[model samples]
Target: MDSGATSESCFAKARKSDKTRRSWTEREEECLIQALKEATTQGWKSGNGFRPGYLAFLENHLKVSFPDSNLRGNPHINSKVHVWKKLYGSIVTILSKSGVGWNDTEKTIEASNEIWESLIKVDNTARSMRHKRWMYYHDWCEIFGNDRAVGDKAEHFAAAVQVVLTMTPELPNNVGMSLDELFSVDEGGAESTSVSLTPSS
Candidate 1:
């Protein structure tokens, strides 16, 4: 191969490796969730999802929180948000079905072996989620709960939100508190509060 071709091949391989190496630590994920909560409080979020440039805001927040992480908005932050939404949607679908339940304490889907067998038969993708533990489910709910599309799906999302609210006792003031108030009062506390999914007028 020519020297120019060899150089291009090496550069492509490096880029691919860098992309594949992107992974989030627990602290980094917490920071990301916090950043997203702050953005929602700032009214950058809408029913359809976060407004344009929110990814840049998230990138900057993560950069400040973990300077060595070198995360970018285009692929890194954007990809993470996409993944959270997809997973959150899947969990919502699972919980919306009959005979399926959410274990708030264990942060996992609760179902019988028969239920799993039936579900997997209909949707093979659900098989992987059988053993998955979603530690950040509530946080993702606060972020994407009200961001659902219109019609039947939106109603399903709302029902899932209600189920979460009923199961969660830590968020006593979920109703009246704005996202800003929720964050401010809990800022010094170890645990983050779940914001009300109702969009601000």
Candidate 2:
């Protein structure tokens, strides 16, 4: 079966399975974030640039982090998948308000191309092709502030570039510095500015 079918099957099974359900704790959430960071840092990619084995890894961490709880045979991966959807959905909403709609792949590509020009202007010293691409992505998040959920994923990077590309043209000259420090809260809220922008730098 295809991925969509597989996901539906798995979730259906989860819904009927007699698994112990527990509330997510603050420490468990931290462990999830750490696992994600490690996966990204280690260049772990599954289908379509998404992390492979992340759910399994997170299950291991949860077992360790919540050792006091009797989590044996719990459907940890399935529960984590549910949590991931909620977290990822919140991020999608925040990006949408920043003018970076994730549904339009063509628009994302167009924005990425446009943002590349701006990245080059900021970092003309980059020589290697790979290095240039890296710099472009790294600066993309900073230009519009950070999205911790997306982290270092390329597709998310491209969408972020699109958001800034769409916003930059409308910025007033005096607010450049403020724009540099602008960011959206991850709670599905609108973007907010943190600093002032000046022409000098």
Which residue pairs come into collision in candidate 1?
none
Weakest 10 consecutive residues of candidate 2 by summed lDDT: 126-135
- lDDT, each prediction: 0.79, 0.45
lDDT of 1 by residue, 1-201 (tens): 699999999999999878745778889989999999999999989766899999989988888978887788888888899999888878887787789999898899999999989888877879999878899899988899877542224433334455666789675764686544433443466433333444559
Question: Which runs of model 1 end up more than 4 angstroms from their true locations?
Answer: 1-21, 149-201
Which candidate should be chosen as best, given lDDT against the real structure?
A: 1
Task: Give TM-scores for every candidate, taking all chains together and pairing residue i with residue i.
Answer: 0.67, 0.34
lDDT of 2 by residue, 1-201 (tens): 599999999998998774556666666656655655565556554433335565566566666777775443236645654555444433333343322233332223222544445534644421122111121222223222232333223233334544656779874455464432443335453432122221244
Clashes of each: 0, 5
Q: Which regions in candidate 2 have their CA more than 4 angstroms from the true location?
A: 1-20, 47-52, 70-74, 98-201
Compare the candidates by TM-score and give the number of the best one. Answer: 1
lDDT of 2 at 166: 79
Error of 1 at 163 (Å): 26
